[model samples]
Target: MSIWGKFAGAVVGAYFGGPLGAVAGTVAGHYAFDRELDKEVAFTIALIALSAKMAKADGIVSPVEVDAFYRICRVPEGEQRNVARVYKLAQEDIAGFEAYARQVAEIFADRPKVCEDVLDALFYIAYADGTLNHAEEVFLRRVAENFALSEADFSRIHARHNPNVFDPFAVLGIDPNASFDAARSAWLKASRENHPDQLQARGVPVEILHLANDRMAIINSAWEMIRKEQFNKDV
Candidate 1:
Protein backbone atom coordinates (compact mmCIF):
# COMPACT_ATOMS: atom_id res chain seq x y z
CA MET A 1 0.00 0.00 0.00
CA SER A 2 1.05 3.57 -0.56
CA ILE A 3 2.07 5.91 2.23
CA TRP A 4 -1.33 7.60 2.19
CA GLY A 5 -3.03 4.25 2.43
CA LYS A 6 -0.92 3.33 5.42
CA PHE A 7 -1.54 6.74 6.96
CA ALA A 8 -5.30 6.23 6.69
CA GLY A 9 -5.18 3.06 8.78
CA ALA A 10 -2.27 3.91 11.03
CA VAL A 11 -2.92 5.15 14.54
CA VAL A 12 -0.82 8.24 14.06
CA GLY A 13 -2.20 9.95 17.15
CA ALA A 14 -1.23 7.03 19.30
CA TYR A 15 2.11 6.82 17.59
CA PHE A 16 3.00 10.44 18.19
CA GLY A 17 1.13 11.67 21.22
CA GLY A 18 1.40 15.41 21.02
CA PRO A 19 -0.08 18.13 18.87
CA LEU A 20 0.83 15.92 15.94
CA GLY A 21 -1.02 13.05 17.58
CA ALA A 22 -4.04 15.27 18.00
CA VAL A 23 -3.91 16.01 14.30
CA ALA A 24 -3.81 12.34 13.42
CA GLY A 25 -6.51 11.45 15.94
CA THR A 26 -8.78 14.20 14.72
CA VAL A 27 -8.29 13.11 11.14
CA ALA A 28 -7.95 9.33 11.35
CA GLY A 29 -10.36 8.70 14.27
CA HIS A 30 -7.89 6.10 15.57
CA TYR A 31 -6.15 6.37 18.91
CA ALA A 32 -4.71 2.89 19.30
CA PHE A 33 -0.97 2.55 19.70
CA ASP A 34 0.87 1.90 16.43
CA ARG A 35 4.41 0.72 17.01
CA GLU A 36 4.92 0.29 13.27
CA LEU A 37 4.86 3.99 12.53
CA ASP A 38 7.95 4.55 10.39
CA LYS A 39 10.15 7.53 9.77
CA GLU A 40 8.54 8.20 6.41
CA VAL A 41 5.16 8.73 8.02
CA ALA A 42 6.68 10.96 10.65
CA PHE A 43 8.47 12.92 7.93
CA THR A 44 5.27 13.41 5.98
CA ILE A 45 3.31 14.50 9.01
CA ALA A 46 6.04 16.91 10.02
CA LEU A 47 6.14 18.41 6.55
CA ILE A 48 2.39 18.91 6.40
CA ALA A 49 2.20 20.28 9.92
CA LEU A 50 5.12 22.61 9.39
CA SER A 51 3.83 23.68 6.00
CA ALA A 52 0.49 24.60 7.55
CA LYS A 53 2.24 26.63 10.23
CA MET A 54 4.36 28.31 7.56
CA ALA A 55 1.28 29.38 5.65
CA LYS A 56 0.04 31.29 8.67
CA ALA A 57 3.37 32.84 9.64
CA ASP A 58 3.07 35.91 7.45
CA GLY A 59 -0.56 36.54 8.50
CA ILE A 60 -1.62 36.08 4.87
CA VAL A 61 -1.94 32.57 3.53
CA SER A 62 -1.81 32.83 -0.21
CA PRO A 63 -3.75 30.38 -2.32
CA VAL A 64 -0.56 29.99 -4.31
CA GLU A 65 1.28 28.91 -1.20
CA VAL A 66 -1.44 26.43 -0.28
CA ASP A 67 -1.30 25.06 -3.79
CA ALA A 68 2.43 24.69 -3.35
CA PHE A 69 1.93 22.64 -0.19
CA TYR A 70 -0.46 20.31 -1.98
CA ARG A 71 1.98 20.02 -4.83
CA ILE A 72 4.99 19.43 -2.58
CA CYS A 73 3.16 16.83 -0.51
CA ARG A 74 1.63 15.28 -3.64
CA VAL A 75 -1.65 14.69 -1.79
CA PRO A 76 -3.77 12.33 -3.83
CA GLU A 77 -7.35 13.15 -4.81
CA GLY A 78 -8.79 10.44 -2.60
CA GLU A 79 -6.69 11.43 0.40
CA GLN A 80 -6.93 15.18 -0.05
CA ARG A 81 -9.63 15.51 2.55
CA ASN A 82 -7.65 13.58 5.12
CA VAL A 83 -4.47 15.44 4.36
CA ALA A 84 -6.33 18.72 4.36
CA ARG A 85 -7.71 17.83 7.74
CA VAL A 86 -4.21 17.30 9.03
CA TYR A 87 -3.13 20.64 7.62
CA LYS A 88 -6.09 22.45 9.08
CA LEU A 89 -5.68 20.76 12.42
CA ALA A 90 -2.03 21.74 12.51
CA GLN A 91 -2.88 25.34 11.78
CA GLU A 92 -5.52 25.40 14.49
CA ASP A 93 -3.39 23.59 17.07
CA ILE A 94 -2.59 25.75 20.08
CA ALA A 95 1.05 24.64 20.19
CA GLY A 96 3.47 26.86 18.35
CA PHE A 97 5.67 25.80 15.41
CA GLU A 98 8.50 25.37 17.89
CA ALA A 99 6.69 22.46 19.48
CA TYR A 100 6.24 20.75 16.14
CA ALA A 101 9.83 21.54 15.18
CA ARG A 102 11.16 20.09 18.40
CA GLN A 103 9.18 16.91 17.95
CA VAL A 104 10.52 16.53 14.43
CA ALA A 105 14.02 17.28 15.62
CA GLU A 106 13.88 14.56 18.21
CA ILE A 107 12.37 12.06 15.82
CA PHE A 108 15.16 12.61 13.30
CA ALA A 109 17.96 13.34 15.73
CA ASP A 110 20.31 10.84 14.16
CA ARG A 111 19.32 11.81 10.62
CA PRO A 112 20.18 15.48 10.48
CA LYS A 113 20.00 15.42 6.70
CA VAL A 114 16.32 14.60 6.92
CA CYS A 115 15.84 17.65 9.07
CA GLU A 116 17.54 19.72 6.36
CA ASP A 117 15.19 18.21 3.83
CA VAL A 118 12.28 19.34 5.97
CA LEU A 119 13.62 22.88 5.92
CA ASP A 120 14.04 22.66 2.18
CA ALA A 121 10.46 21.52 1.80
CA LEU A 122 9.29 24.46 3.88
CA PHE A 123 11.38 26.83 1.76
CA TYR A 124 9.71 25.44 -1.35
CA ILE A 125 6.30 26.26 0.08
CA ALA A 126 7.38 29.64 1.42
CA TYR A 127 8.64 30.85 -1.99
CA ALA A 128 5.87 29.35 -4.07
CA ASP A 129 4.06 32.69 -3.97
CA GLY A 130 7.06 34.37 -5.67
CA THR A 131 8.58 36.02 -2.60
CA LEU A 132 9.80 35.22 0.90
CA ASN A 133 8.52 37.86 3.27
CA HIS A 134 10.40 38.98 6.36
CA ALA A 135 7.97 37.22 8.66
CA GLU A 136 8.26 33.99 6.75
CA GLU A 137 12.06 34.14 6.81
CA VAL A 138 12.04 34.66 10.54
CA PHE A 139 9.65 31.75 10.99
CA LEU A 140 11.82 29.48 8.85
CA ARG A 141 14.94 30.52 10.75
CA ARG A 142 13.29 29.66 14.04
CA VAL A 143 12.29 26.30 12.66
CA ALA A 144 15.87 25.71 11.55
CA GLU A 145 17.16 26.65 14.97
CA ASN A 146 14.79 24.23 16.58
CA PHE A 147 15.95 21.56 14.17
CA ALA A 148 19.53 22.25 15.29
CA LEU A 149 20.53 23.44 11.84
CA SER A 150 23.45 25.79 11.56
CA GLU A 151 23.37 29.33 10.17
CA ALA A 152 25.27 28.10 7.10
CA ASP A 153 22.73 25.38 6.59
CA PHE A 154 19.89 27.87 6.71
CA SER A 155 21.67 30.27 4.36
CA ARG A 156 22.38 27.59 1.77
CA ILE A 157 18.77 26.40 1.80
CA HIS A 158 17.47 29.96 1.77
CA ALA A 159 19.72 30.90 -1.14
CA ARG A 160 18.45 27.96 -3.14
CA HIS A 161 14.82 29.05 -2.76
CA ASN A 162 15.10 32.82 -2.58
CA PRO A 163 14.13 33.94 -6.09
CA ASN A 164 14.92 37.57 -5.41
CA VAL A 165 18.64 36.91 -5.11
CA PHE A 166 20.98 34.54 -6.87
CA ASP A 167 24.22 34.16 -5.02
CA PRO A 168 26.03 31.21 -6.49
CA PHE A 169 28.55 31.18 -3.69
CA ALA A 170 25.87 31.14 -1.03
CA VAL A 171 23.95 28.45 -2.87
CA LEU A 172 27.03 26.22 -2.85
CA GLY A 173 27.89 27.30 0.70
CA ILE A 174 31.37 28.27 -0.48
CA ASP A 175 33.32 31.47 -0.18
CA PRO A 176 33.31 33.91 -3.11
CA ASN A 177 37.09 33.80 -3.27
CA ALA A 178 37.34 30.02 -3.22
CA SER A 179 39.44 28.44 -5.94
CA PHE A 180 37.77 26.71 -8.88
CA ASP A 181 38.87 23.36 -7.48
CA ALA A 182 37.31 24.11 -4.11
CA ALA A 183 34.08 25.29 -5.72
CA ARG A 184 33.93 22.16 -7.84
CA SER A 185 34.37 20.03 -4.74
CA ALA A 186 31.60 21.89 -2.97
CA TRP A 187 29.26 21.41 -5.91
CA LEU A 188 30.02 17.71 -6.10
CA LYS A 189 29.44 17.23 -2.39
CA ALA A 190 26.20 19.21 -2.45
CA SER A 191 24.96 17.34 -5.48
CA ARG A 192 25.63 14.01 -3.79
CA GLU A 193 23.97 15.13 -0.56
CA ASN A 194 20.84 16.49 -2.27
CA HIS A 195 20.55 13.61 -4.69
CA PRO A 196 17.15 11.91 -4.65
CA ASP A 197 18.72 8.54 -3.91
CA GLN A 198 20.55 9.98 -0.94
CA LEU A 199 17.40 11.62 0.39
CA GLN A 200 15.37 8.43 0.04
CA ALA A 201 18.07 6.44 1.75
CA ARG A 202 18.04 9.02 4.52
CA GLY A 203 14.28 8.53 5.07
CA VAL A 204 12.65 11.28 3.01
CA PRO A 205 9.42 9.90 1.55
CA VAL A 206 9.62 8.87 -2.07
CA GLU A 207 6.55 10.95 -2.86
CA ILE A 208 8.45 14.12 -2.03
CA LEU A 209 11.76 13.24 -3.68
CA HIS A 210 10.99 16.01 -6.10
CA LEU A 211 12.28 18.26 -3.35
CA ALA A 212 15.68 16.78 -4.01
CA ASN A 213 15.24 17.12 -7.74
CA ASP A 214 14.38 20.80 -7.49
CA ARG A 215 17.24 21.38 -5.09
CA MET A 216 19.67 19.56 -7.34
CA ALA A 217 18.63 21.79 -10.20
CA ILE A 218 19.34 24.87 -8.11
CA ILE A 219 22.68 23.51 -7.00
CA ASN A 220 23.70 22.62 -10.52
CA SER A 221 22.63 26.02 -11.76
CA ALA A 222 24.82 27.68 -9.19
CA TRP A 223 27.73 25.45 -10.12
CA GLU A 224 27.36 26.26 -13.79
CA MET A 225 27.23 29.98 -13.13
CA ILE A 226 30.31 29.81 -10.98
CA ARG A 227 32.14 27.67 -13.51
CA LYS A 228 31.44 30.14 -16.28
CA GLU A 229 32.50 33.05 -14.11
CA GLN A 230 35.75 31.31 -13.27
CA PHE A 231 36.45 30.54 -16.95
CA ASN A 232 35.87 34.19 -17.82
CA LYS A 233 38.25 35.36 -15.12
CA ASP A 234 40.89 32.85 -16.19
CA VAL A 235 40.66 34.15 -19.78
Candidate 2:
Protein backbone atom coordinates (compact mmCIF):
# COMPACT_ATOMS: atom_id res chain seq x y z
CA MET A 1 0.00 0.00 0.00
CA SER A 2 1.06 3.58 -0.59
CA ILE A 3 2.29 5.59 2.42
CA TRP A 4 -0.88 7.71 2.44
CA GLY A 5 -3.11 4.67 2.05
CA LYS A 6 -2.05 3.54 5.49
CA PHE A 7 -3.45 6.64 7.19
CA ALA A 8 -6.39 7.67 5.00
CA GLY A 9 -9.45 8.01 7.20
CA ALA A 10 -7.59 5.70 9.53
CA VAL A 11 -7.51 8.26 12.31
CA VAL A 12 -4.46 10.28 13.26
CA GLY A 13 -4.96 9.40 16.90
CA ALA A 14 -7.44 8.39 19.54
CA TYR A 15 -8.74 10.58 22.40
CA PHE A 16 -5.50 12.41 23.02
CA GLY A 17 -5.98 16.17 23.27
CA GLY A 18 -4.34 19.24 21.71
CA PRO A 19 -3.36 19.96 18.14
CA LEU A 20 -1.64 16.63 17.93
CA GLY A 21 -4.82 14.88 18.92
CA ALA A 22 -6.85 17.19 16.72
CA VAL A 23 -4.79 16.15 13.75
CA ALA A 24 -5.11 12.56 14.87
CA GLY A 25 -8.85 13.05 15.31
CA THR A 26 -9.28 13.68 11.60
CA VAL A 27 -9.96 10.00 10.91
CA ALA A 28 -13.55 10.63 12.02
CA GLY A 29 -14.25 7.05 13.02
CA HIS A 30 -13.12 4.25 15.31
CA TYR A 31 -10.73 2.84 12.78
CA ALA A 32 -7.98 0.67 14.21
CA PHE A 33 -4.93 2.20 12.62
CA ASP A 34 -1.92 -0.08 12.68
CA ARG A 35 -0.15 0.49 15.96
CA GLU A 36 3.27 0.03 14.40
CA LEU A 37 2.51 2.27 11.49
CA ASP A 38 0.89 4.72 13.89
CA LYS A 39 4.33 5.56 15.24
CA GLU A 40 5.68 6.18 11.78
CA VAL A 41 2.61 8.22 10.89
CA ALA A 42 3.06 10.31 13.99
CA PHE A 43 6.63 10.96 12.95
CA THR A 44 5.50 12.05 9.51
CA ILE A 45 2.61 14.12 10.77
CA ALA A 46 4.76 15.90 13.32
CA LEU A 47 7.30 16.77 10.63
CA ILE A 48 4.89 18.03 7.97
CA ALA A 49 2.44 19.56 10.39
CA LEU A 50 5.15 21.50 12.21
CA SER A 51 6.64 22.60 8.92
CA ALA A 52 3.25 24.09 8.05
CA LYS A 53 3.31 26.16 11.23
CA MET A 54 6.93 27.11 10.55
CA ALA A 55 6.00 28.53 7.19
CA LYS A 56 3.76 30.85 9.13
CA ALA A 57 6.47 31.60 11.72
CA ASP A 58 8.59 33.17 9.02
CA GLY A 59 5.63 34.95 7.43
CA ILE A 60 6.38 33.42 4.02
CA VAL A 61 7.21 30.06 2.56
CA SER A 62 9.89 29.95 -0.09
CA PRO A 63 9.62 27.59 -3.02
CA VAL A 64 13.01 26.20 -2.10
CA GLU A 65 11.81 25.33 1.40
CA VAL A 66 8.83 23.56 -0.09
CA ASP A 67 11.09 21.75 -2.50
CA ALA A 68 13.45 20.86 0.34
CA PHE A 69 10.56 19.35 2.30
CA TYR A 70 9.66 17.13 -0.63
CA ARG A 71 13.25 16.10 -1.13
CA ILE A 72 14.16 15.52 2.51
CA CYS A 73 11.02 13.61 3.38
CA ARG A 74 9.76 12.31 0.07
CA VAL A 75 6.08 11.52 -0.30
CA PRO A 76 5.41 9.21 -3.16
CA GLU A 77 3.26 10.38 -6.03
CA GLY A 78 -0.56 10.19 -5.57
CA GLU A 79 -0.25 10.69 -1.83
CA GLN A 80 0.07 14.46 -1.81
CA ARG A 81 -3.52 14.94 -0.78
CA ASN A 82 -3.15 12.77 2.30
CA VAL A 83 -0.09 14.76 3.35
CA ALA A 84 -1.88 18.00 2.50
CA ARG A 85 -4.72 17.07 4.81
CA VAL A 86 -2.47 17.19 7.86
CA TYR A 87 -0.54 20.23 6.63
CA LYS A 88 -3.73 22.24 6.16
CA LEU A 89 -5.04 21.13 9.52
CA ALA A 90 -1.87 22.27 11.26
CA GLN A 91 -1.71 25.67 9.57
CA GLU A 92 -5.27 26.29 10.70
CA ASP A 93 -4.86 24.88 14.19
CA ILE A 94 -5.76 27.11 17.12
CA ALA A 95 -2.85 25.76 19.12
CA GLY A 96 0.52 27.45 18.84
CA PHE A 97 3.41 25.83 16.99
CA GLU A 98 5.43 25.53 20.21
CA ALA A 99 2.63 23.45 21.70
CA TYR A 100 2.93 21.00 18.85
CA ALA A 101 6.71 21.14 19.02
CA ARG A 102 6.61 20.39 22.72
CA GLN A 103 4.33 17.45 22.14
CA VAL A 104 6.71 16.09 19.53
CA ALA A 105 9.68 16.70 21.81
CA GLU A 106 7.95 14.67 24.50
CA ILE A 107 7.09 11.90 22.10
CA PHE A 108 10.74 11.54 21.16
CA ALA A 109 12.24 12.50 24.47
CA ASP A 110 13.85 9.12 24.89
CA ARG A 111 15.36 9.42 21.42
CA PRO A 112 17.40 12.57 21.23
CA LYS A 113 18.84 11.57 17.88
CA VAL A 114 15.34 11.53 16.44
CA CYS A 115 14.75 14.95 17.90
CA GLU A 116 18.01 15.99 16.28
CA ASP A 117 16.64 14.76 12.99
CA VAL A 118 13.57 16.93 13.48
CA LEU A 119 15.80 19.97 14.01
CA ASP A 120 17.83 18.97 11.00
CA ALA A 121 14.67 18.88 8.90
CA LEU A 122 13.73 22.35 10.04
CA PHE A 123 17.17 23.75 9.20
CA TYR A 124 17.04 22.07 5.82
CA ILE A 125 13.77 23.83 5.06
CA ALA A 126 14.80 27.18 6.49
CA TYR A 127 18.07 27.21 4.57
CA ALA A 128 16.70 25.81 1.34
CA ASP A 129 16.67 29.28 -0.20
CA GLY A 130 20.43 29.52 0.43
CA THR A 131 19.70 32.00 3.19
CA LEU A 132 17.77 31.49 6.37
CA ASN A 133 15.81 34.70 6.97
CA HIS A 134 16.08 36.40 10.34
CA ALA A 135 12.62 35.38 11.46
CA GLU A 136 13.11 31.86 10.21
CA GLU A 137 16.49 31.61 11.90
CA VAL A 138 15.07 32.81 15.18
CA PHE A 139 12.14 30.45 14.92
CA LEU A 140 14.46 27.54 14.26
CA ARG A 141 16.71 28.64 17.08
CA ARG A 142 13.72 28.44 19.38
CA VAL A 143 13.08 24.96 18.09
CA ALA A 144 16.59 23.88 18.90
CA GLU A 145 16.32 25.48 22.31
CA ASN A 146 13.07 23.67 22.97
CA PHE A 147 14.54 20.42 21.76
CA ALA A 148 17.41 20.92 24.24
CA LEU A 149 19.89 20.69 21.41
CA SER A 150 23.17 22.21 22.52
CA GLU A 151 24.47 25.25 20.69
CA ALA A 152 27.18 23.10 19.19
CA ASP A 153 24.73 20.52 17.86
CA PHE A 154 22.42 23.20 16.51
CA SER A 155 25.29 25.01 14.80
CA ARG A 156 26.55 21.76 13.36
CA ILE A 157 23.24 21.15 11.67
CA HIS A 158 23.20 24.75 10.51
CA ALA A 159 26.64 24.35 9.01
CA ARG A 160 25.55 21.27 7.08
CA HIS A 161 22.96 23.17 5.07
CA ASN A 162 25.20 26.08 4.17
CA PRO A 163 28.23 24.66 2.41
CA ASN A 164 29.65 27.98 1.30
CA VAL A 165 29.96 29.21 4.85
CA PHE A 166 30.17 25.89 6.67
CA ASP A 167 32.60 25.82 9.57
CA PRO A 168 34.22 22.40 9.90
CA PHE A 169 34.62 22.60 13.68
CA ALA A 170 31.12 23.98 13.96
CA VAL A 171 29.84 20.93 12.13
CA LEU A 172 31.45 18.81 14.84
CA GLY A 173 30.33 21.26 17.51
CA ILE A 174 33.86 22.04 18.67
CA ASP A 175 36.30 24.91 18.82
CA PRO A 176 39.42 25.04 16.68
CA ASN A 177 41.40 25.41 19.90
CA ALA A 178 40.14 22.01 21.09
CA SER A 179 42.43 19.04 21.27
CA PHE A 180 42.56 16.54 18.42
CA ASP A 181 41.50 13.81 20.81
CA ALA A 182 38.35 15.71 21.69
CA ALA A 183 37.55 16.30 18.04
CA ARG A 184 38.15 12.65 17.18
CA SER A 185 35.92 11.48 20.01
CA ALA A 186 33.15 13.85 19.04
CA TRP A 187 33.34 12.78 15.43
CA LEU A 188 33.18 9.08 16.27
CA LYS A 189 30.24 9.53 18.59
CA ALA A 190 28.34 11.64 16.07
CA SER A 191 29.17 9.17 13.34
CA ARG A 192 27.65 6.28 15.23
CA GLU A 193 24.56 8.28 16.15
CA ASN A 194 24.01 9.37 12.54
CA HIS A 195 24.46 6.06 10.78
CA PRO A 196 21.57 5.38 8.42
CA ASP A 197 20.84 1.99 9.94
CA GLN A 198 20.72 3.48 13.42
CA LEU A 199 18.25 6.14 12.26
CA GLN A 200 16.05 3.51 10.61
CA ALA A 201 16.11 1.48 13.78
CA ARG A 202 14.89 4.56 15.60
CA GLY A 203 11.85 4.69 13.28
CA VAL A 204 12.91 7.63 11.12
CA PRO A 205 11.21 7.87 7.72
CA VAL A 206 13.26 5.94 5.15
CA GLU A 207 14.03 9.07 3.16
CA ILE A 208 15.30 10.73 6.31
CA LEU A 209 17.30 7.66 7.05
CA HIS A 210 19.02 8.05 3.69
CA LEU A 211 19.98 11.54 4.74
CA ALA A 212 22.19 10.00 7.37
CA ASN A 213 24.47 8.93 4.56
CA ASP A 214 25.06 12.52 3.58
CA ARG A 215 25.36 13.60 7.20
CA MET A 216 27.81 10.82 7.86
CA ALA A 217 29.88 12.05 4.95
CA ILE A 218 29.79 15.59 6.24
CA ILE A 219 30.93 14.55 9.69
CA ASN A 220 33.83 12.61 8.20
CA SER A 221 34.78 15.54 6.03
CA ALA A 222 34.80 17.81 9.06
CA TRP A 223 37.02 15.42 10.93
CA GLU A 224 39.31 15.09 7.94
CA MET A 225 39.69 18.83 7.68
CA ILE A 226 40.29 19.18 11.38
CA ARG A 227 42.81 16.35 11.26
CA LYS A 228 44.76 17.71 8.32
CA GLU A 229 44.86 21.22 9.66
CA GLN A 230 45.20 20.56 13.36
CA PHE A 231 46.80 17.14 13.71
CA ASN A 232 48.87 16.81 10.56
CA LYS A 233 47.09 13.55 9.81
CA ASP A 234 44.67 12.09 7.27
CA VAL A 235 41.45 10.37 8.33
User: What TM-score goes with each of the models?
Assistant: 0.94, 0.88
Q: Model 1, 28-117: lDDT tens per residue?
A: 577766544678888888898999999999887789999998888887898888888888889988999999999889888889989999
Query: Model 2, stretches more than 4 Å misplaced?
Result: 1-5, 9-16, 27-37
Q: What is the lDDT of residue 184 in candidate 2?
A: 91
For model 2, what is the alpha-carbon lDDT of residue 2?
Answer: 35
* Highest-lDDT candidate: 1
Q: lDDT of all predictions, in order shown?
A: 0.86, 0.75
Which candidate leads in TM-score? Answer: 1
Instruction: Report the CA-based lDDT of candidate 1 relative to the real structure.
Output: 0.86
**Segments in model 1 whose C-alpha atoms lie over 4 Å from true places:** 11-14, 232-235
User: Candidate 2 clash total?
Assistant: 2
